[model samples]
Target: MNKHSITLSFEINEPQLLLRDAIKHYGISKKALTSIKYEGGTILVNGEEKTVRHILTVGDKVTIIFPEEKSSEGLIAEKGDFPILFEDEHILIFSKEAGLSTIPSREHPHGTVANFVAGYFAESGLSSTVHIVTRLDKDTSGVICVAKHRHAHHLLSEMQKAGTISREYEAIVHGFIQQDSFVIDAPIGRKDGSIIERLISQEGKYAKTSVQVLNRFHLQGEELTHVRLQLHTGRTHQIRVHMMSIGHPLIGDDLYGGSQKFISRQALHARELNLKHPFSGETLKIISPFPKDMKDIIPTKTTK
Candidate 1:
């Protein structure tokens, strides 16, 4: 009957403590909080579902849509493109480019892979069930897996949860790393008046990434290392955060470290993946070569 609702924004230097204070002040459940994660929700700093506990940093914006008395829900959408990598009776893997979201979120409503893929399926006269098992950030590129049916979706998702799926990434960081390989084992959570950007937290989720030096190149005489990263545990911004922690932040990761970029999106790609077939029990391994943008950064083997 009334359209009046509370819309308040708070800027906090210590977001975690302030969020704790806000919850107490407003007496709202943690779930009612939009996009705030506790090393927490799967939503990201840019407003995607990120699974990490986040403590607020200086000048973080916390917006509260306030409590709901009662509510109804609907799935409304707009459309875009869906690049098909491989598809079969039940499984579909796609080459999702930078600027395409793997699924739906409050922040990226229009330019998402899900909406695009669903539309693509319709044009082809397919069922268009389009069940996404995992998601990539709006600016990250490469392979994403989805299911065409609910049964298939649940099975593959379960396998992913059980550690049966292997995902690998490629990134160009802003420095030359000496180690042939390194592992980043960090627990992450929320920070700032925001809910999505993750920071180290003992109360955070388990995230591990292993990186191997792929090559080194010069940009304006400054050398930057391109790396192949493997994920042991996937968390919000795992590669971006891990690389930043090691002083080799991604070339175009403005949130982590923004420098040394040639592309409009983050210079990260999900280059390879391995998984077990949800229904057939067959092992599936998929690899994607560097997209033209990422490939351009490296010199030919003869040149090096």
Candidate 2:
């Protein structure tokens, strides 16, 4: 097997179960099974090739070999130095910095996390393509998740839809928030005539963000509040829009009525992520420390 291919084996415990049912029970999608059948892959029972319809008795061993994957075209491999929080055969977690795009775009075609990951994969001789499961905004620094294969990507996507993936962010906003904790339940939609901006509207999709005030301090004669935010729904600019709607825009977030008095980018960092490992079914909690720009503004006496 190549570096990009995966082989999984299981001991059948139930009697007279179809191989197809067993595979499905193990979380292999029908599309993936179809690919294994048509593509260069194999399924074996007791060390012999077998069809999906074959009956499996207790003590039988089932093995599946997945086809090798290919990297996407036009995804150039570029070496870069970034912090890798955790990595395994199934997934890679990165502590990305600000001012770097997560993936290539029309405006930014290089120096992205995806390009760096592609370079790493090439150096490791793995043909798997870049599959980013969780992406952060260009100006937001935080923890990002990348899947190493298509099966892991599919499972992570499903986990996201089921609300099993959770993220927490720490942000410094423009004003002193009086509330200790609150939830901003609003609808977010694309702003009219602008593809990059989002606004809270009645006709928009449901979005909820819970906010907790961490500290209130004075910086250069301006009142600022450090807050921790938890996202209950994934929406474009949801945290920015929700914070702005509550009269406290993020510091340096000029697009959302904030001023860049002390910081260069939005003073937001993805602080924590909680999720289950797709392959091992174990809970994984990853964290990213505050970047230098944001950390410098906080008082030395205050704790994060």
C-alpha lDDT score of every prediction, in listed order: 0.68, 0.91
**Candidate 2 residue-wise lDDT at 97:** 94
Q: How big is the positional error of residue 66 in model 2, measured in Å on the Cα after superposition?
A: 1.0
Mark the 10 consecutive residues where model 2 has the least summed lDDT: 295-304
List, residue by residue over 1-304, the lDDT tens digit for candidate 2. 6656888899999999999999998888888888889888899999999999999999999999999888868898999987889999889898999998989987778999999999988888888889999989999999999998878888899889889999999999998899899999999999999999999999999999999999999888898999999998899899999999989999999999999988988999999999989778789999997899999999977533
**Which 10 consecutive residues of model 1 have the lowest summed lDDT?**
66-75
Off by over 4 Å in 1: 1-80, 105-108, 124-129, 301-304
TM-score per model over all chains: 0.70, 0.96
User: Model 2: how far is 132 from its true place, Å?
Assistant: 0.2
Best by lDDT: 2
Candidate 1 total steric clashes: 31
lDDT of 1 by residue, 165-269 (tens): 899999988878888888889987676687768776778888888889878778767778888998888788888887887788888788877574566667999
